[model samples]
Every structure is written in structure tokens, then in C-alpha cells.
Target: MTLKHILLGTIGATMIAAPAAFAGSVTPAPADPVVATPVAVALTGDWTGGYVGGQIGFGDVDAGGSDSGAIGGLTMGYDHDFGTWVLGAGIDYDFADITAGGNTLENMARLKVRAGYDMGAGLLYATAGAARADIDTLGNDTGYFAGMGYEHMVTEKISVGGEVLYHAFDNFNGSGTDVEATTAQVRATFRF
Candidate 1:
């Protein structure tokens, strides 16, 4: 065979066989493995009942001067939860012995109205109401107080919280002295 004829024949044979040769070597890519993602579960509680609790903390009073001491008290209230919002009324009492400028403060009481946001198993709240304070020799006076608190449910019937309050009594006991007090306390409550 001549050189030109031999080269032409060899090129034609390769062209016909190229597709089948590469086809057998081709592969399909493997599909990605299935994956599962985790989801978080939300906590919920119903706070539509009566609750009673006890609190203990420190109090600082400014009645012409400043006096600070330990104060403790008992609290009772009823909460009605409206989905994410809660409203309630409560009454509490604290026994204290703080002396300011020779005046001894004996005990205090409050009639409170509370509004809060329900945070699943917890409640973040604000409180305001009338306060009655008794000071030795200065007698008793009525005033107003506002505060904030947080309570978390520990069990179906028990919860714990902390509160900080500001109380103001202008012209305390007819003495023309404005009395202002701040108190911080921790509380534990039982639901009924």
C-alpha cells in the first residue's frame, strides 16, 4: 500500500472507534447524601391563677437623710395571662427597721397592680401601686411606688423572681419632708 493510502485508512478507523472507546469510560456522578436538620422546641406555660410568695432583700431610704438595712416581706397575687401579656393585682408587706435622721422606719405595705410579658416559662413584669409606710415617732403615711421584676417558673406550682422598687412619699406624715426609698428583693412563689 502506498503511504498516503495507509495514513488515510488509519485516520478513518480511529474516528469511527473514538466514541465507543470514550463512552465505556464515562460515569454518572453520585447524588448527594440526604441530611437532616435539628429544630428547637419552644416552652409554654399558663399563668392564670392565684400565687403567693415570700421575698427578702435590702432597702435604702432617703428621708431628709439616707438609711439602709435588710428588709423582708410576703407577697400574694393573682395573674391572668392574655397570650403574651399578663395583668394582675397583688398586696405585700415588709418589716423593716431603718433609722433616718433619728427617725425609725418600722414597716411598709403596698397594694400593687402588675403588668407583664409572658416569656414562655417566665414573666417579665412592671408594678405600680399605693404604698403605706410607718416610721416610729413619725407615724404612717401613704404614697406611690413603681418597680420592675422577673419571675421564672421552676415547677408547676413554684416560681422564683427578683424585684426593684422606687417609693415616694411627699410631705411624709405631715412633716413636709419628702421620703424616697429604693428596695431590691428576691422572691419565691407558690401557685394555687
Candidate 2:
């Protein structure tokens, strides 16, 4: 072959091989390091404060037999929160006209201490305390109460809840009669 033919063949071969060589040597840019960012969720408000509320309930009183009626009252309390747990104390007064054994039971009051588990916008609690009940002819008698309750926050300042409580009084009015009561109530509260 003449020099011209040889030169052209060499040049054509170089041109075709150049792209292949470059393609083999080149690598894609390292994909941007996959960064893992944590996502956060919003939770409900805190439960550390003072509160005032009202409740209405119906209960059966057993003094020899059973008598049932409606009861309503006002409640006030303060709570301290510690992470997942809460502690509190409260007082309530109720007016009722429950009759059993030919006697009318009227006013009632309770002082309680409570402990609860915090559940974001809600609380589950248990309470126990001293109670006093007034009877129309038998005067006032002292007793004890225990209960469990659940409350849910509807707003930053308001909550709604329900509770079931049991009360027992032994040898009421110096007589041989005993009293036992169970109450189920719904309540609404405002927090400060």
C-alpha cells in the first residue's frame, strides 16, 4: 500500500477507537450520598395545670336494698406531669336525692388523690379518697371511694372524660345499716 492509503487507514481507526476508549474510562458521577433525615411528628398538649369542671352521674345506693338517682357536681383539681406520668389531687361536691330504706340521701363531698398515665392527648387514671354523705334523717357519715377514669383533650384548654367510682360506708349513723354505692359519670373540664 502507498503511504497515503496507510495514513488514511490509521487515522480512521484512531477516530473510531477514541470514543470507545473514552467511554470505557469515564464513570458516572458518584450518586449524591443518600442522606437519611429523621421525620418528626407533632403531639398533643401537656397536662400540667389546674382545672375546674362539672360532672353528672347516676348511681345506685344499697342500704339494705338498692336506690338509684341522678347526681351532679363541680370539680376542681391540680396536676403535675412528669414525662409519661401525672399526679394530682381534687375535690368535688354533689347534690343528690337518693332514697334507700325509707331514708333520703342528699349532699355528698369527696377529696381525692389521683395518679395517671399520660397518652399524648389523653389520660388514663385511678383515684382513691375520703368521702362524706349526708342523709336526711341520719345526718352525715364518712366513707371511702375508688375509681378509674379516662379523659381526652378536645382543645388546648378543654377536656372531656368519664369515670366509674365505688363508695362504701360501714355502720352508717351509728345504726347497723351499711351503705354501698356505685356511680358512673361524664365530665367536662377547663384547664389553666
Candidate 3:
């Protein structure tokens, strides 16, 4: 071959092999940066404040004869939370008309003290209190009461609960009759 032919062939061969020879030396593009996603967590409620609320329930009074009826009322209270435990005081009034034999219960009121355990969004408690009951014929009488209750926070400001209370009164309104009453109530409250 002539010098021109040899030079052209060498240039073509170099052009063909240039890309393959430089392929190993070329640096690859950097990989995409790693991205981390955040995790979500649930929040619990705190119970340490004052509250006002209402309650509705059924009451059964055993005075000579058994008389059961519906009872409803208003309630207000304050509470202090100490981590795993809580304590509070409250007052409530109930309007009722339960009749048995010759006696009729007109209404009732209670002043209570309670202690409970904090369970995330819920509370389990025990209560004891002084109760007053008014009878249509026998006037009014003072008594003692004990109960158990469970309450849950439905929102930051609202709560719902249920309670079962037992009451005892001796010589109701000085009429020489002993009275025993049981009440089961559902309650809703607004917290501050």
C-alpha cells in the first residue's frame, strides 16, 4: 500500500478503537442520594384540670319495696394527675321520681371524692361521697355512697364515661325506714 493509504487506514482504525479504549477510564455518574422517610407517632392525653359535665342514668331504691326509675343530672369537678395516678372531687344533682309503696323520692345530690389510674386515653376510678335524697312525704335525708367508674377522653376537650354507685341511708328523714339505692350512669364532660 502507498503511504497515503497506510495513513488513512491507521486513522480509521484509531477512530474505531478510541471509544472502546477510553470506556474503562471514564468515571460513571454518581448514584442518586438516599432519601429517608419520617415515621409517625401517636400522642396520648393528659388529665390534670377542672371539668364540668352532665350525667344520665337509672336508679333503683330498696326501701321496704324495690322501686327502679330513670335519673338524670348535672355534675362538676376538678382533678389532679400524678403520672400513673389521679385524684379529684366533684358534685352532682339528680332529678328523680321513684315511688315504692307509700314513699316517693323527689331528687338527690352528691359530693364526691375519687381516685383513679391513668391509662393512656382512659381512666379507671373508685369514688366515695355524701349523698342527700329528698322524699315527697318524708322530707330529706343524708347518706353515704360508693362507686366505680371508667372514663375516656374523646377529644382534647371532651370526655365520656360511665359510673355505678351504691348508696345507703338509715332512718330516712327520721321516718324509721332504711333505704338502699343503686345508680348506673353515663357521663360526658368538657375539660379546661
- What's the lDDT for all of these models? 0.92, 0.90, 0.91
Best by TM-score: 3
lDDT of 3 at 69: 97
Poorest lDDT segment (10 consecutive residues) of candidate 2? 22-31
**Per-residue error at 142 for model 2, in Å?**
1.0
Looking at model 1, which ten-residue stretch has the lowest summed lDDT?
Answer: 38-47
Runs of candidate 1 exceeding 4 Å displacement = 1-43
Better of 1 and 3 by lDDT: 1
Highest-scoring model, lDDT: 1
Candidate 1 per-residue lDDT over residues 10-127, each given as its tens digit: 9999999998888865577687998989886444767889999899999999987899999998999999999999999999999999898787778999999999999989999999
Error of 2 at 165 (Å): 0.5
Where model 3 places Cα greater than 4 Å from the true spot, the runs are 1-43
TM-scores for every candidate against the unseen true structure: 0.77, 0.77, 0.78
Question: How many pairs of residues collide in each model?
Answer: 0, 0, 0
Over 4 Å off, model 2:
1-43
lDDT string for model 3 (5-112, tens) is 999999999999999997775587688999989985433658899999999999998877889999989999999999999999999999999986678888899999
Candidate 1 lDDT = 0.92
Q: Candidate 3 local accuracy as lDDT?
A: 0.91
Q: What does candidate 3 score in Cα RMSD to the true structure?
A: 5.6
